[model samples]
Target: MGRWAVATERRRGEALIRAIHEAVLAEVVDAGLGQLTMEGIARRAATAKTVLYRRWATPFELLIDALGEAYPVEVPTPAADNLRTDLIAALTLLTDWMVTPAATAVMAITSERGRYPELAEALWDKVFDPRGGTFTTTVLRWYAARGRLDPARLTPITTQIGEALVFKLAIDNARTPSAEEVAAIVDEALLPALGL
Candidate 1:
């Protein structure tokens, strides 16, 4: 078979969904959320629009699924009680994800949430909520459950420190924070907030 024929081989199940997810994320980043369409995603994924409709009713639903698929879950060191290290790692994951197409699409949705409130709501309900809410939350909870951290300290404000600072620095600097910056956020902001 020719290279063209080989490249056109049909994808099914997980493979097809992965391609469609990637296509939606890329489409949102390249075309913006408001411009996203089934046709555009199908064109990008090299699949028929009908294939997209088979799984998702709308491009926004597809985009939310893509973001959820791409979102990283923080895995705390269960045996080791290194809160600082785990917190830094969680924020590092956030910084790494911040540079991805999925993250870009998420930012696009959140930035224009007023225009697309439902999309933003779905993003939180489907993506962020399912994935341990936010960076450092899982780690903090792990530490708390083990008595390494006080459960009382694991409040909403404390859990959000690392993410809020990471986002603020990224917005202010217009770039993803470096590893050193991620570490500093854990040490300076998150640890202090947790009373450690």
Candidate 2:
């Protein structure tokens, strides 16, 4: 292909991907994940079904990508000078996202993981862990830098305690955790576990 043809193809590919993403979000919101299909998304996005097939082997893959884009979480570096306060702030961001429509959709999609094993792995690999890692990794390293992180509790599971609590509350209680509850999770559970 010529240089101009290659550039044009790249631009069109970008536009098609964007359109597919938007179409997936619309399909999820309108029809729910169970009902989403490549044909429907292609029609919604005004693109060829072959285009989607070329990129994603299944609707689950497309759904994961769409969820990643639709529910972009901002991981804030908490600078509260103490693990408790910093963790509370960081955990609050996750707690807040837990109650959003996007999260609800994610929960719905994940619940069907029994049917689509790949969806379960993709949701964690593409959507949750990547965003969750940003906060957990940053906070752990920040505390470690100050020689505050307990060497025994320096694993991924330990870093996830606060967000895990928030997720549990969101799932079990069907409500966003209160500020006090968020703080309590950080201070009472996570801090103690971390030996902080």
Residue clash pairs of candidate 1: none
RMSD of 2: 5.9
> Weakest 10 consecutive residues, lDDT, candidate 1?
78-87
lDDT of 2 by residue, 1-196 (tens): 6987876563276677878887877777788777989999998988789989998988878878777876645433454256666677777767666655566667777677787677778788887687645445566667776667755677878877777788788778878889999888877888788776
lDDT of 1 by residue, 74-173 (tens): 9999775788888888899888888899888888988999999999999999988877788889888788788888899988899898899999999899
For candidate 1, what's the RMSD? 1.4
Deviation (Å) of 124 in candidate 1: 0.9
List TM-scores for all candidates, in order. 0.95, 0.70
Model 1 shows how many backbone clashes? 0
List ranges where model 1 is wrong by over 4 Å.
2-5
Please give the TM-score that candidate 1 achieves against the real structure.
0.95
